[model samples]
Target: MPTAVQALCANFPDLTPPATLALRLEALMPSRRLPAGRVLFAQGQSPSAFYLVEDGEIEARFAALDGRMSVLEHVRAPRLFGLAAFISGKPSRYEAAAVSDSRVRVIGAPAYRVLMDDWPGFARALMREFAERFEGNLRLLEAARHLSAAERFGVALRQLADERAGPSDAEGWQALRATQAELAQLAHLSRQTVNQLLRAAQAEGRLRLRYGGLDIRR
Candidate 1:
C-alpha cells in the first residue's frame, strides 16, 4: 500500500512531491490491467472499484437500444474513471473497454472510504476526479437532451473543436478513434448523414479527416 504512492507520484500529471505524493497515493489505489477489447467494467454492473488509467487507452461506450456501440468518450493514460459508480454505489453507466493494452489503478470502495477519512490530500484528489466526471457527464447529457438532429450535429463539432484545442503540452489531442458508425449512433443519425456532415465541415475548413482520425482546425 505504501509503495503505491511512489507509483502515483511518477504516474500522475498532477502529482505533487515524492514523499508526500507517495504517502497520498499508497494504499489508496490498486493496479490492474486489461488487453485490447477487454471489458474493464460493464454498464449496469455493480460498482466495486474505481479506476485510474496508468497506461494505454480506454473507451467509455454506451450500448444503444438496437445493440449498437456508441463511444461516448475516450480515456487515455493518466486519466481517471470508474469512480462515479463507486461513489454512487450504482451500476456503471457505460461499458468501459480497453482500446488498446492498458493498465489502471483500482481504488476499492473500502480503501477509498478509509483514505477519504484519514488522508485529506488524497481525498481532495479523489473529489476532484469525481467532480470532473460529474461535470463531463452533465455536459454530455445536456448536449444530447432536447436537441434535434441538426442541433446534435452542431454540438458534435463544437465538442470536437474543444477537444482538439486542449493542451498539446499536456497530451496530444484525444485520439479520434471514433468510427463513423459510432458517431452516427451518438448523433442519432445514419452513417451516411454523419459522412455528409463531416464532408460539409471539411469543405468549410472546420475539420479535416486525416488518415489517423478527423482533425478539427477550430
Candidate 2:
C-alpha cells in the first residue's frame, strides 16, 4: 500500500516538490480516522485545518433556519475540503461530516502557509484546484437557470457518474452509489420529478435502478 505522501502525490500530480520538501510536508500533515456520520467541522467554526480525504466519503452540508440540513457537496476520496475557508481566514460556510467511515490527512493552516510560501508548485496546484471548482459552480448555476427538470437531472447524473461512479463494465454501464432522493437533491428537483425522470431514462435504456443505487449507461 502507498503511504500518505504517495497518495497525496498521486491525487495532486501538479504538486511536485523536492524530496526534502515532500518529507517536510509528510511530517506536517497527520492522518485521522472518522466514523460514519461524524462531523469534521460545523458551520461558522473557525478554520484550523484543511483535510485531504484518503478514503471513504465526506459531505459538505448547510443547515437551514428550520433545522433542516442539505448536502451541498459530496467529496470522495482523493479530494481536498475546507481549503477555501482556511485560506480565506474565515469561519466555515458549511458543516463537513463523514458520509462513511473515513481516513483523512489534516494539513494545518500554519503548515499550509509555510508550503504556500516556500513551494511554488504547491501554490500553483492549489490555485488551479480553486479555479476549477469555481468554474464548475458557475456551470451548475447556468444549468439551474436555463435547463428543464429532465435536462437538469441528466446533467446531475452525468456529473455524479463522472466524479464518483465505479468502473465501467464491458457493457459501458457504471454503478453510481446514490439513491433517488440524493439525486433529487443534487439536481435541485422534487423527488417525484426525479423518479419520473429515472423511469423515463430507464425506459430509454440509459440507466437501470438498483436496490440502493443506479447503473448508468455511459
Candidate 3:
C-alpha cells in the first residue's frame, strides 16, 4: 500500500504538485495515528497545526454547556481539517476526534505558508477545498432555515449515505454505518425525533435498521 502522504497527494490528480515539494512536505510533516474515539484537538485550544486525514474518519464536534455534543462534520480520508484556526490565528471553536482508527498528516502553519507560497497546485487545491466547504455550509444554512425537522433529517441521512455508502445490494439498497445518536447530532435533532423519523422510514420500506447501522433503499 502507498504511504499516507502518497495517498493524499494522489487525491489531487489534476493539481499535482512537484515531486520535490511533495517529498519535502512528507519529510517535514509528521503523521499521527489515532485510535477510535481519540481526541485529536479540543475546543478552545490554540491551533498548533492543521490536519489532512489520510485514513479513516475524524469528526468535528461541538460540546454544549449542558454536556451535549453535536457533530458538525465527519471528515473522511484525503480531506483537510482545522485550517480556519490555523489561518485566523485563533483558538479552535470545536473539538476533532477520530471516529475510527485514523492517520492524519500534521502540517504546521509555517510549512503550510511555505507550501502556499511556493506551490501553485497546493494553493489552488486549498482554495478549491475552501470553496466547496463554504458552498456546503451555505446549503446547510438554507436547509435549516426552510426545511422541517423530518425534511432536515432526510437531507442529513442522504448526505451521510452519499459520503459513506457501502456496496449496494441486488435490490439497490446501500448501507450507512452510523448510529441514531450520530444521525441526531448531524441533523441537529433530538434522539427521540431521530428514532421516530427512522421508525417511520422503516415502516414505509425506505430503510431497514441493522445492529449498528441502516440500509437505505435507493
* Top candidate by TM-score: 2
Model 3 agreement with the true structure over 137-218: per-residue lDDT tens digits: 5655566678999988887887678667899989999988888887787777889999999999999999999999999986
What is the model-wide C-alpha lDDT for candidate 2? 0.81
TM-score against native, each model: 0.73, 0.87, 0.83
- How does each model score on lDDT? 0.67, 0.81, 0.81
Error of 2 at 66 (Å): 3.2
Per-residue alpha-carbon lDDT of candidate 1 for residues 1-218, written as tens digits (9 for 90 to 100): 22555444444446454344444555557678799999988999977887767778888888889997776776775566777777788888789999899988887866666556654466677677667656755665666787776677766555544433343333243335345765665566788988888888789876668775665543
List residue ranges in candidate 3 displaced over 4 A: 141-146, 166-172
Question: Per-residue lDDT tens digits of candidate 2, residues 112-148?
Answer: 8666887767777877876876676565556677999
Residue 128 in model 1: shift from native, Å?
4.0
Ranking by TM-score: 2, 3, 1
